[model samples]
Target chain A: MSFKVRQEIATCGGKLLKLSHFSELIGLSMDVNVYLPKQYYSKDYEKVIPTVYYLSGLTCSPDNASEKAFWQFQADKYGFGMVFPDTSPRGDSVPDDPEKSWDFGIAASFYVNATKKPYDKHYMMYDYIHKELPVLLDEHFSESSTKKLDFLDNVGITGHSMGGYGALTGFLKNYDANRYKSCSAFAPIVNPSSVPWGQKAFKGYLSDDENDWDKYDPCKLIKRITNTRNDMILIHQGTKDPFLKDNLKTDLLTEASKNTSWEGKIDIRYADGYDHSYFFVSTFVPDHARFHAKNLGLI
Target chain B: MSFKVRQEIATCGGKLLKLSHFSELIGLSMDVNVYLPKQYYSKDYEKVIPTVYYLSGLTCSPDNASEKAFWQFQADKYGFGMVFPDTSPRGDSVPDDPEKSWDFGIAASFYVNATKKPYDKHYMMYDYIHKELPVLLDEHFSESSTKKLDFLDNVGITGHSMGGYGALTGFLKNYDANRYKSCSAFAPIVNPSSVPWGQKAFKGYLSDDENDWDKYDPCKLIKRITNTRNDMILIHQGTKDPFLKDNLKTDLLTEASKNTSWEGKIDIRYADGYDHSYFFVSTFVPDHARFHAKNLGLI
Candidate 1:
């Protein structure tokens, strides 16, 4: 219903803005971590930099990605701004899950367009994150042709696990597919159709028709359509992930890539002994940002 | 009871062991994060590496230091093993403050010898962390050297907030203080006797006598004793931290060091716009590690 600016910390000349906003979208007061690149405070109003939005996985809020992954160093190096959105709504008339855990209720929104009754109103997370949140970020955080980022600079997308799924599907279905110069993910769940989390959330959110699942499946979408701008996708998967066998099917992605073509290429690196955690992401996020920078012509 | 390792990821040719343990010491199981340096797994059994244990402040678990602080990059670089023990015992057995939200009961144990009952039993966290945990870590992990440390080489201590107090007291009282080559912290609670957190935990766990608090207070102890070692203590504090004036009193440390006739030195840096969060620590840990590494003769 109402949004508040909780805290703002100036980091490396730029500002790290922590905002609390009531989302008609996610139906809770969401905390977003927005980074205005050093250029924003450089006094050069004409200089504009590209932007990158990072979505986090289940059971995690905006702070997890902003604080844990150490992404700012890379953002500083690459001269890009980063936006991190909380995973789900909290502290409203929202219903709590009977099982009190990190997953399922508060944090484990699968980033889907919810259709279920109690969840549908507040659970419009997909729209809020992909549509409304970005709009608000662009308006409040973005420079007014005024400085850091140009009025028309395209924004890139990247995430992990559920976020990776959101990054893929949201970018694909959104109007700004061409705006993102490059996309990447770390240990992302590829085919939700075949995973337990996917099965659970999908059954509750989507109609029972399995045919509709492919519309949201990244592996399936990649297979069905050719790229609009790039030839390949950049992905990093851990070989020893606990959820790899059941949830994240990189094999299916490999299989899908074989059939479908993109604009440039797909660079998939399978790191050994990493897991479905922030440690794995922190280890490779610099490289991922570099990957996007290269595609975006920043490097 | 039962000890189960949730995850163990190899890093820098060693392992970042995340295990949940059944504690006879704490009376309940706790999740701990341990880093066994490469020397632990090396073929040369005669080689000994000094370890630097890190303690975190309030609302932090073992994972905070291990995962969020970005210390491993430097730990590997410096060739020193790192061990992070949980701040307090978890689960229902650990009595929480009925009123307070963040500070007193669960996350904020002052790492002193607990004298209060109920809490005194499970809250002997100081000994559990500094003594018993190290022994358990040695038995389970490959780095099974309890008291054995490389005195001739480099050993150091560093922490944040309450953990900073632990590092200061721990290093000062080591059976061999000369073993520690360096000392540092980020926004540490300098004079625990003066702060609310210190007052609460100390009054609860320790006697009301103010002089007794000096044993654990770095600023107090520094004035009363002389350092045999000829190394400098590095401290990094954020200028904008809300708790800077009252909670973290580095000014007392500055005054004490000025008057103390010690051979050791203190170098404190006040970073601008940073807060008392891992975001602040992660931003500066590399420099801290590098400082230790240079002193450790690894750089």
Candidate 2:
């Protein structure tokens, strides 16, 4: 698959390349934004630049976080590249929510591989993000250079809201294989199987079996996975977030980790008076960048 | 002149107060956003907080800069409050562009008092922004407090594109009166009298008298104003900005300053690979904040 450059925007100490490519897995074109840090453009830089993938929340395209999250500055500060993948596949062939709801349709793929009819044809976001996209990026961006940009290894993952759930699930699911070196989130949905937004998405994309939903739920995965290293999952939740009460029950993840290897390793910081908006995400991005940088060995 | 609190959003150790109030000067309700830094909320804060006024470019509301410019973090870092004033008067009664174009009427007031028919009725933005807004904000916000917020004295002014022109004109025209302590611009049209955008706006708002436009034009004002304080106006112009060659001839300001008291005082820093967007503005906000902080005696 070849990546097409849509726009190259200069921001902070680097360039944000808006790219689109045809995905054989999804059978449709997908959009993703990649931010190359200042270090990559430096004359003396020789080391391979690590990447930090940011998954956005509900009803968002790649542009939302790419435009507003203020990640470019942090990426430059930490000398790390950034990858912002789209939430779902979008095209005429892509099946939308029957009811035309925002939380269940085109923008809300939940980062899960679909097993149901219609959706199964194209909604393979889990494979697209976690597997295909990384390999493709590594191949495409490293073609002309002796120094490489690491996309798979020595990479960290972070997200917000639904994408937060995606990051945690992906990180924990592939922990044994050592997939993501670091993981963090801003107001993520920790217990997705128990939340309304996740329940609707799970039912729409996955099979009717409840066991299918449990595999993708972070709360359930944390209970089973044993942390071999002294690894930590950083998370920030706003006390004033409207979804905290109903959907993003962050405490459940901590409670589920009790007596498990992740008991004290889940650092969930409760921010005061913040909400479920980019204002909240951008505020905590610097801290997340530092955490990811340390894990990726950039700091 | 009471302000209605539309929304109070917590952002980066500050609160962005979205307020709407009736403006007697413009004969319409205006929306404005004021950010109170963390210093304002500190129990030990005794010093009166200074403010920096940010004016947005064409086709913008107060929310544009409040949401995208990433200024809240800088305001908190420098311990300064921020004021984002609306560009023009708006209502059903207000006249719009005859061609329904975005550059004229409605959002495009060009920060000038209209002297022509139809627009003259409510398009008195010059008085509304520079004269009335500060007094109204001071009166309303200081009513219940012993410590005052300095909206009038010890304040800085900066803007983007058209608003950049506004900042330069305002700073130079009121230099003798000591209206603003500091001034800066991002990709500003330095010589509006010689530009097409300026010509259209000036013709539509002011009468056929070219002398009326000369008063508001920064190039003309820079030649006449005496910079006795050795004050320097900081400006950042992106080299890749599409409007640089056309509407925004930044070099004209420097040329006009030559042989005058303000020669070499107009510091225009040409940023590489940047454009005319919030991405460009947000990148340079920290620099502007520090500049203003120094001038406002906060540093």
Candidate 3:
């Protein structure tokens, strides 16, 4: 990862640092924000905390997750590291869909392997989160010191919307059994096959083959979890979420888990009067932090 | 305020409600996210809690603070209201400075009464916080209910950078002594007279007469306070802030409070290797919340 340390400022608590990293991995130079807990530099150098990688939904960058999620308090108190990466690659010349839509082109990069002609080159978010980012995060920040390559000292993953799907499947698929112990999501698109966002992005990013689409779907992937991580997966969904009925199939996941080993392991909470936005996610983020903290044994 | 209630989602043991409130005051349709505590609709409607209004710095809107500050957990546990307002009035015709500087145009409203010609119409943020917005908040949100307001229910104002200045002065000047109680800031522009941001904003928003600047200046306002409201004021500043020298005058406010009734009442915490941003604010927001909770007798 050939990246430039754009700006590093000492925040009121920890360090608010930004880095511009570019690679052939993703077409654009991603801006990443790392919030190293106060304990990062404290006398407890040997003390390593579990890291949480937050992927923003669409049209967001590292700055969005860093600014919007309000996770630092939990990170600092819970003693965890947070890594935020841009949702999709960006630049003027990059090829985009002929039609303009919020879901495709700029803001939306389905966390899948884009097999389509135009987007296939740079839409490699799966690798960015799974392989490349871990290396990049370890190299630049203090969390790099905790790079034991073991899931216990190293990591956990979570995100909202598309990013949450990434977090759900990314941690499920990527981490060595030793490195990833827990995963959670906030209002994630569960059955992407049924959701408009997922269907559109999937069709554009992948071939017509439904098998390829299954690989990226969390609902489909949850069915394939051979062994559970920890005991349960925590998911908070809003009952009033505009897209919940059409897009986020919390019920489908609930039913699927009920019939599988994942039964009693999927904790699906139906939050009332909420929507598909960060405000819903931000409200419950600390709970996610606490959830991870408890299960990860960080607390 | 003709606001379209878009979506209200409840989660994180609370409620996340989004609304599109059009401020004839700002001539812009603003997106605001309000977090209602779990007990908001409980049987105990009379239960009062302290509310903290977080003002975003330049180039930020209400959306930024709600997205980033990461305050909900504490707000949920401690039971306080958080009100986030957009930085400046925005609209197509709203005059922006010819120079698209981050500090001057969209993000930076200076929070003072803008005396400049174009900004004069919509830049009435001073009134928005003190008068119009409060009425709207009380009308829509439970915390703003009359019983809660009667207790002089603890009202603490806090913010980062320019918003910090707004929090400081807003509390000092227009604060309903009978209602709002505590005041704190994170890396505020204490004495705008000394900082470039202060000089530019003061000149644009106020009269050329330097004496008038004292009205909005926190250091100057400190000397104006004859009786301390709650016990003291809390300020957390980053020593390594990039704009520490140019934008913030911590020493001036520190010295000013030292000579007044606030002498021992001012709690100034200087954190090492931090800067003027939300990362810094989030690191210490819990302490500030605890400070208000204690002063409000919520512990």
Top of the candidates by lDDT: 2
Residue range B1-299, candidate 3, lDDT tens digits: 34566755555566555677876676667666666666565666566755677778988877666656667766777787677777887778777777878887577887877777877877888777766776776665544344453222456778888998898898877543644577788888889987898888877777888778998898888787765554677898888788888779687887877767767767889987777767677778889889877766678
Weakest ten-residue segment in model 1 chain B by summed lDDT: B144-153
lDDT of 1: 0.73
Q: Considering lDDT, where higher is better, how would the candidates rank from best to worst? A: 2, 3, 1
Please list the C-alpha lDDT of all candidates, in the order they appear.
0.73, 0.92, 0.74
User: For candidate 3, lDDT tens digit of each residue in A207-253?
Assistant: 98999988887677767767644467788887777777787777887
The TM-score of candidate 3 is 0.84
Chain A TM-score, cand. 1 = 0.89
Could you give candidate 1's per-residue lDDT for residues A1-299 as a string of tens digits? 23366888755446677878766666567788877766666664444677788889988888888877777877778778888887777775765455655556567677776676666767677778767876766565443335646212466788998888778777665523464566788778778888888877777666778766777787677765644554356788888788889888866777766745642355779887777778788878878889877866787
Task: Provide TM-scores for the models.
Answer: 0.84, 0.98, 0.84
Kindly give the stretch of ten consecutive residues in candidate 3 chain B with the minimal lDDT sum: B143-152
Predicted complexes: DockQ each? 0.33, 0.72, 0.52
- Could you give candidate 1's per-residue lDDT for residues B96-207 as a string of tens digits? 7677668777888777867777677777776676566666755654454443335233566788988887787766655244645767788888788888878887887777
Model 1: C-alpha RMSD to truth?
4.3
Each candidate's interface RMSD, rounded to one decimal?
2.9, 1.0, 3.0
